[model samples]
Target: MIVDSLDIQKEIPLWALGDGEKVIQREFVFENFKQAFEFMTLSAEYAEEIDHHPDWSNSWNKVSVSLSTHSVGALTKLDIQLAKAMDAFASQVNSKN
Candidate 1:
């Protein structure tokens, strides 16, 4: 599913991946670096499980992740699924810290 701007806005912290409109993006904020890394680890496991990788960065308490089904040249079910998994991981990390 192509994530439209409207849907993106409604979901806090998640934005349609930019990069010339070819991916899905989300930025998650945590209490500190430790929490952020924890989320990253969880996301990594999930990504590996599905064989869907993401472009991501982490600085202090913030983690930015971008997902794209490069082979398809657009956002697909995989992107949305990863986004949701990331969201879940973020919530889990936040609650612990």
Candidate 2:
């Protein structure tokens, strides 16, 4: 089911685009390319484990991430869960810097 934007906003303040269009977006910047790659690696594994994937891209030390439930055409619990997990992974990466 699609989540309410209000709830999403409270949970995901780092979202670059307001969580009103069935998508959650954020850009995570790391200290370096290696750190960025490490984040992606961890994210990829978690995504696979959960059977949900993100639309993302990486450039140098940055990773742009977008999450949406494509089959439902909206943000669902999975999207929120994945976003939180990704945020945690990003936080861990940054803390190591």
Candidate 3:
């Protein structure tokens, strides 16, 4: 489906996938930098597998990721899928420690 940017923004934090109108944001917190980095690595792997990239930053134990479908001008299934993948990775990492 051609997920419109407007439709995606209407569902903030839940389905809003992408930076601005094209980026999805996900914040992950961990007990320490080691754990945060671990999650980042896993997330990187997932991004590579799908060939969908994210803009992210790491500050101590917190990591923020933003996903955008640059090719599409707005949000799409790829963006949503990537965001879900990131959430899953964060959940798995958090559960481990």
Candidate 4:
């Protein structure tokens, strides 16, 4: 089910909330490329496990992520969950550096 935009706003206020098709987006920066890759690797495993992938890209020490349920072309719990998981992974990766 598509999650309400208002709920998403309340849940992750730091993320950029776009209207309609733009969806939710956030950028994570690491101390180095190695740390960035670590975060992505962790997120990839989790995404695969849940069968929900993210639209994301990495360059050097930064990663940009956008979350939405592509099947329905809308925001959903899966996107929210993946966003939070990626956030946690970023935290863990940053802490390790």
> Among these predicted structures, which one has the highest lDDT?
2
**How far is 94's C-alpha from truth in model 1 (Å)?**
0.4
Instruction: For residues 1-97, write the lDDT of model 3, one tens digit per residue.
Output: 4576665566445544434565667688888898899888998898899898888899999998777777876666877777777777778888886
What's the CA error at residue 45 for candidate 4, in Å?
A: 0.1
What is the Å distance of residue 4 in model 3 from its true position? 4.3
Candidate 3 stretches with Cα past 4 Å from truth are 4-20
Position 2, candidate 2: lDDT: 76
Deviation in Å, model 2, residue 47 alpha carbon: 0.2
- Tell me the lDDT of model 4 at 33: 94
Q: Judged by lDDT against the true structure, how good is candidate 2?
A: 0.91
TM-score of 4: 0.92
lDDT of 2 by residue, 1-97 (tens): 7788888889888885445577889999999999999999999999999999999999999999999998988889899899999999999999996
Of models 1 and 4, which has the larger TM-score? 4
Candidate 4 Cα lDDT to native: 0.86
Tens digits of lDDT, candidate 1, 26-76: 788999899999999999999999999999999999998888888878776
lDDT of each: 0.81, 0.91, 0.75, 0.86
At residue 87, candidate 1 shows an lDDT of: 90
lDDT of 2 at 7: 83
Ranked by lDDT, the better of candidates 3 and 4 is 4
Candidate structures ordered by TM-score, highest first: 2, 4, 1, 3
Candidate 4 Cα outliers beyond 4 Å, as residue runs: 19-22
As for model 4, its CA RMSD to the true structure in angstroms is 1.3
